[model samples]
Every structure is written in structure tokens, then in C-alpha cells.
Target: MKKLLVIGLLTLFITPFAHAQFGVKGGLNVAELTGRDGESASYKAFYHVGVFYQAHLLGPLSIQPEVQYSLQGGNLKSAFTNYDSQLHYLTVPILAKLTVGPVFVEGGPQFGVLLNADQSGNMQVGLAEDGTPAYGNVSRPATGSFKRGDFSLVGGAGLKLASNFSLGARLVAGLNDINDVQNLSGINDPRLQNRVYQVYAAFQFGGGK
Candidate 1:
């Protein structure tokens, strides 16, 4: 069912290609993990790059669908260790846009497939002879414990400076728990979700009026 939905959306996005405007976008992402038990998480800065197609539906309204490759995740400090998790995803967002003058607002549903997940950090190994704590770098694959799919909502507002240039900011909030770890002890675990803030610039090519 989910796979079918994804395929349908992809088909819809490309079906109007000849009449749509093509654009490229790249941005910075401030990402973090939400709903962690008692542990606090910090934001991790990452980036996203994508291409999109926009088609006018009516006066002041348009549909924009995008394909993006994003790097996300968060940082955590637990006990004597610091951890940074890197999550790589391929995402699709189907947005409905409203334009007024040079300003526009958009909101949409986004679907993502996780490509990889990894954690790299430093852990306190022992105490030095001088009584200072010693640390060692550690790295591990985290993909096995996380869900393969991510569902989210995207919302933003932006300004079009010209026919081919624009700037925007967006917020993407995860709509589903992305943790897939199994607890054999029958204890409920905290749900993990993705949260991100983005600022980007877009450049468009000729298409619609």
C-alpha cells in the first residue's frame, strides 16, 4: 500500500513535465531528534539538495513536487559520551502553493526513504594517570535499529525576487515514529521523530507564465 502510494505520487509528479517549470534548490538543515525518553538532544547542522517541477493550476495557485537528498539527525551527550547520528534520506514532497504578488506560501506531505544511518562519537574509556578522563572515538552502524521509511509534513513561506530566483524557509516535522528497535523485555521505549528547519534558495528555468 505504501509502495503503491509512492509510485502513484512519482507518476503524478512527472506526468506534467512538459508544461512545468524545472528548478534546483539547495539548503541548510538544522535537525534534531524529538521524543527521546529522558535524554536531551542537540541540533545538528546538515544540508539538502534537490530538483523540482512546478505547474500552475490556477490564478495564484500551483503544485510543486520535489525530489531531494537530505542529511539529518542530531547530537546527544549521555553519561560520559557524546554521540552524533547521521541519517541520509531520499525524500519526495508534493506541495500546494499559493502566490500573492511576489510572496508565496506552501504546505505539503513528504515521504522519505532512509538510505543510511550511522553514529560517530567519543566515549570516556578510562581515567588518565593525572586523574583526567580519557576518551576514545567510536563509530557504529545505526541503520539496523531504525525504520526504513519516514513520513513528514512540510510548510513554508518565501519571496520570489524575479522570474528565476527565490528564497524560502521551511519546517518539516515528522508525523510518524521512526524507531524500529524491538524491546525483548516487554518495556515500552520512547518514540523518536525527526524535526528540521530549513532555509534555501531556488533557481527556475523557463516554463509557464
Candidate 2:
């Protein structure tokens, strides 16, 4: 993880040094985690802020790479309780951008490292007077840290406004499972999956040169 961060930082610094342009971007994200049963957990609104450098490689193509810290997660409401599962990620996406007149299309893979996970809701440990821990259902534990294959796929599109700016949205989808099974027989429920989807709008700075 440290090596990856170092390489990403170096790339960001070197790219701008080569092209001499830098920009700041901030956007909103609609994020959700999907389970294996084909039912989405829930959708939550998150935020993203980052910096990027665009390096021109050819006439119509350029490499736009960014490093962003993003908040992502989902919420679940059942009859017993409601809980929200949130996570923080450091993501790096390197996109190949194409431009034609005033419109542009970009898509690429994103590498993300899990920073943290949080859960907030009615957590019931034991019974008060009537029932066992039945009525008060606590949210399941989120292992938080991901294993070796925590990277995800990211792709999206946007439109250019002026010569120096653009507005666009992208989707980030995780490719790995989020749970680690210690005891197979203890947990028979199969609605566990770690795939996440995020929709975000990006604001580009500096002219595309």
C-alpha cells in the first residue's frame, strides 16, 4: 500500500511537471453496495475531492490521472432496526480521455485502498425484559480491511464546458468480496457481497492542452 501510494504521488508530480497544468476537483457521489441475491443493500450519498494532472500524449488523446479520497457505503432498514455501513477509500484512477469538439469520453480502471468502515444504528446486545437478543438486532460486523484483491473497475462519461473545464460523472464498481468466512456452518446466510457502485461528477481545471 505504501509503495502504491508513493508511485501514485510520483506519477502525479511528474505528469504535471511534464505538462505544466494542475487542477482541483470536488463532486458528489451516490454509492451503493450490491449483494449476491441481486438486491441492492441501499444507496447513500457520499463526497469526493481530489487533484489531477492531464498530460497530452497525442492530438485527440490524453492521460488524466487523479488521486481522490472518497466516502462510500450503504444503508439497510429492516423491521427490527436500521443501520448504515460506511467506508472510506483512497482511490486512484487513470483515464484515457478522448475529445471531439466540445464533448469528451473517458473510462478506465480504478485502484482503491480501504481506509475505514463504520456502522451506526440501534445495536442490541441482550434483551431488556421481553425477548432475547431477537427484537434488538445488531448490524453484522464489517471486517473493514480488504484482502489482496481490493481493486475495482471504474468508468464514466462527461461533457466539456469551456476550453479549460468540464463536467462529467463516473461509476466505480468493486470487484472483490468483502467478507471473510471463519465458520461456514455458523453463518448460513448467503447475501454477502462486496461490490460497490459510485456515481460521481467531476470538475476539471486547467485547459486541455
Instruction: Write the residue-wise lDDT of candidate 1 on 143-178 in tens digits.
Output: 976799999999999999998899999999998998
| Model 1: colliding residue pairs | none
lDDT by residue for model 2 over 91-143, one digit each (tens)? 88888878788777787887877676776775434455754443354555454
In model 2, the worst 10-residue window by lDDT is 181-190
In candidate 1, stretches whose alpha carbon ends up further than 4 angstroms from where it belongs are 1-19, 122-137, 183-188, 207-209
Q: In terms of TM-score, which candidate is strongest?
A: 1
TM-score of 2: 0.71
Q: Superposing every Cα of model 1 onto the true structure, what RMSD results?
A: 8.1
User: C-alpha displacement of 28 in model 2, angstroms?
Assistant: 0.7
Q: In candidate 1, what residue range of length 10 has the lowest lDDT sum? A: 181-190
RMSD of each: 8.1, 7.8
